[model samples]
Target: MAHKNQFQLLASRRFLPFFLTQFLGAFNDNVFKSALMVMIAFRLAADQANALNNLAAGLFILPFFLFSATAGQLADKYDKAFLIRRIKLAEIGISLVGVVALISGSNTLCLAVLFLLGVQSAFFGPIKYAILPQHLRKTELVGGNALVEMATFVAILGGTIVGTILSGASDSGGGSEWIGGLIIAIAIVGYLVCRVIPDAAPPVPDLKIDLNPVRQTAHVLREVAKTPAIFYAIVGISWFWLLGAAYLTQIPSFGKNVLGGDEPLVALLLCSFTIGVAIGSLLCERLSGGRIELGLVPLGAAGLTYGGIALSVIGGNLAPLEEVSLAAFWGSPGAQMFLFHLALIGVFGGLYIVPLYAMIQERTAKALRARVIAVTNIMNSLFMVVSAVLGIVFLSLLDFSIPQFFMVIALMNAAVAIFVFSKVPEFAMRLLVWLLSHTMYRVRHEGLEQIPAEGPAIIACNHVSYVDALLLAGAVRRPIRFIMYKPIYEIPVLHFIFRTGRAIPICSRQKDPEGYARAFEEIEQGLKDGDLLCIFPEGQLTKDGEMQPFKAGIEKILQKTPVPVIPMALRGLWGSFFSHKDGHAFTTWPKRFWSSVSVVAGKPLDADTAKSDHLHQVVLGLRGERL
Candidate 1:
């Protein structure tokens, strides 16, 4: 059965076993790690406990740095389902060792177990993401990713709480044996759950394994550098992890120092952020209409910045109290606002990350997908470590207050977003298209599925307004290269989008013969490169709310590059502000706001029969008096 929403995947065998395995694994890891940290804190001296906690954290992250490259090779060389089962079995053995360590009170053994768990996680990391595309359809990618992200954060929150509670119970005269049993039970169950996962055959089964971590990691990084879009996506994902880690690490301190709240209040803060992320992650599928929407990335960035700035301002306004209770903290100035901003950051964070992950998985070559994921994991580890170091420098050495540090991080986020988006203008162009489609008009697409999913094709449409290209861009899933009149292509802000979208600008032969030739050269190159190209068959916008006669430019295009042509029409745009209805385009006030518009596409027509007149008739019939 087809799934309408991400949650429905939970009920299907194709996804359920894998989802449970991933969720259980993350849950078990955090449970053990949190329990270990809590146990050390309560049992050892304050200084000793602090040192061991830091050591434990370092141990967990070290495996990714050391073994990730090798692990990526293994994932690419073997069935992921088989690897996952083996990894889960190893987790059971590790948990058995952890049980003995916890009950025997051996700090060294506990740290060793932590390191082993990290190793297990490192090996599983690449397979976890790489397997999704093997199982899910292209349309389901975003939803699948959203569900996974939501589950992961939820697992973190749930596991942390459970571990903390179990550790506290032990401190209150409960025996350590209970914690041990629970850990062993979780590991065993995880193994059982993973056993049923469907086999994911390796993409590069014949590839030789590289045993050296340094050489393999360097090699992988070089491969990743070849695709700048995927590389920057990895950077963007890593930066997000850094940002998230910074906020999570500081929250407890923020609660106690800034708000003068207790452990309970700190937990509440954590809940706010985690729950918000869960909501936002789930919302991604809905917001993007189940597609990997790049537009949401910029929106998420904006929300994160706003949330951070608001938090800093609210935090600066608060007065620290002496041991404030949760109830009293709620009554204190800015408490509600503080929590809201934290949650907002998390919500936008979810919006920011899901699409990026889906994009990486979809765009990367299948043979190298796992290794690319491995590179991202390594970068994530490094960025998180850097975040910790920077935290120390800002809050300790630089003597910046918590609020000021927050402000600095927010500004850094802005700067980083600008750098990434500017480097890849597709993101910025998507943002503009998404905003225009969502705000200025309500666009309904018809027969869009007729557009080819891959390969080169031409789209000949009736151009009703200057914004028709933007609307079409948003409506179609694949990116399009527009062939537009030079004057319209050069509209200030719109020019940035068109140029970034690699649009071709042309003038009449009499006006500029050289420019006209260059435009056709670009068009031919674009088609040769397997790009989707769109042209306004009418040549220009209509002077009235009526169909304009199709021009010969499309015929010229087809003569040179005979791709299948899809006739399209835009309705309800003729009288809009961007159209020349009562006066020249954009010269008069808008006739309406959030007006209804429709983009109707027809089935592909053979290049030989798709003459200008025939295509114009088809588009007009499709439009069907809507204007």
Candidate 2:
């Protein structure tokens, strides 16, 4: 079957409502927060402005620390659609309170409303991620997440622009109250849209709600710890938020105080940053080939650090132009230069985050996914709080200007990224594989990460093409030991590559008992040394696309040295030049530059259930119904 296009997936009722709901929520968040910030900056007491603005920011983020644990538990325990609707209803109520505060003209009440909005977001956090896998197929996860991310950043830009414009206009005509009312009205519309979100069944219906924040938070942390990769991914995500929060909080002040820009200029700076993120998000689907490819995280982080430094350097170089014109202010040569740097930052940001989000969804178990996301939110909030405090300390004690501070942050981001990638060589190795596959062919992967990073992993895949091993090897980050037929393993030119890759030659027991014994012994030794050993249980390459009967060799190997057996299925390989399906194998390569293929890896099966028939069926399921 032909794969579904991005438009079709995006247009479905299942996805659109949730998309709109999330977009609206993000938009409203920025609108309200930006509007309030503007009010404090321009209208509030001048001497108290900084203190109050800082306090307001703190209040808004405090709810995440206090309520995210509860929110995560609730999302996992209840139907997501119902939970979302109720959250929307609460937004409507919060917006009403904003209206009342505006009419009453009380800054205190307005700040209180901001705090309430934060609480509302904390509740919505878990449902946002938990609902995704339910609505999207495994193939669509990357694209779906990209769209959601794109929409969110776009909404953030829109919100900042709207809030700035509305707040400025209100300042002139004493219509700030009316604008506040209008914001509330928009929020109510958002709630109504959320009501139309399709139902998603809860993952754990009988899951008890853990009301104790500390205990619940601990429980979620323990759950994440079960998967080492997932735990690290969470830490990476938290670090991103920390880096982002600090940079975002500094931008407005940077533009106004450092760059000598006005309110509109500050909005433009934010817009540039967010637009970069949106672009990055959209590019993820194409780059990852519709899978959660974590390799891009390093690439994205590199861009962020580079862009930040570029922006800072540009800021330091600011000078008076020939004419004091609006165009000069908006797009002077220097301003243009800065904007270019910001856009690069956005492009890279897109590369870094999209894959991480996809990995989190793909790796975690279904039941615990939402709660894990909730844990992420809590971490994000805590990081942001820390960032705010750090920003204040750095600025006050060291007297670092905004430009200098951003430079420091850029350097810090680079340092942290280096640390992460070094600790996880798998990321770097995957990046190498990703680069090779994209350069050579339009490769698609389903279960690439299923291959054990270390130790004995018996990869049972249906033999379809000569390139199957290459594709599998490229997808996996670890070195693999492929048990191959002796004839193919001795091919003059290909033999060198195979030998270097440490592939073992295997022969039928009746044909060569010594060769068979050697292959089995080699595999056992590999397991002892913690190496990934892959065997095609089908024994020979398929002449046609249909699967062949399982070879009992895999059963024998496991019987003697039992280890985790991972079942895999490779699709769209039969018709390629490497496959024997055509009159002459390797005669003609596929015409398309990026034709899609899928390699799915199912959950590891224990040795006891690793029977030949059961393993055969599992491989078929991973391949889906396509082949």
Provide the overall lDDT of each model, using Cα atoms, as 2-decimal numbers.
0.89, 0.79
Report model 2's TM-score to 2 decimal places: 0.78
Which tens-of-lDDT digit does each residue in 1-627 have in candidate 1? 447899988887778899889998899898889999989999999999999999999999999999898899999999999999999999999999998998888999999999999999999999889999999987788899998999999998888888888888887665467778888898899899888899999999999998898899899889888767788889999999998999888988998877778778889999999988988899999987787888999899889888989988998998886547887888887888998999999999999999999999998889999998988899999999999998999999999988888898999999999998877777887787777767777778899999998899999888788888888887887778999989999999889878877899987889999999999998988998899999987777788778888888888888999999988888988788888888998899887888889998999998899998888899899999888
List residue ranges in candidate 1 displaced over 4 A.
218-226
In angstroms, the error of model 1 at 67 is: 2.4
- TM-scores for every predicted model: 0.94, 0.78
Worst 10 residues of 2 by lDDT: 1-10
CA RMSD of all predictions: 2.2, 7.2
User: Residue by residue across 548-594, what tens digits does model 2's lDDT show?
Assistant: 88878888888888899988888777676667766667677655455
Return the clash pairs for model 1, or none. none
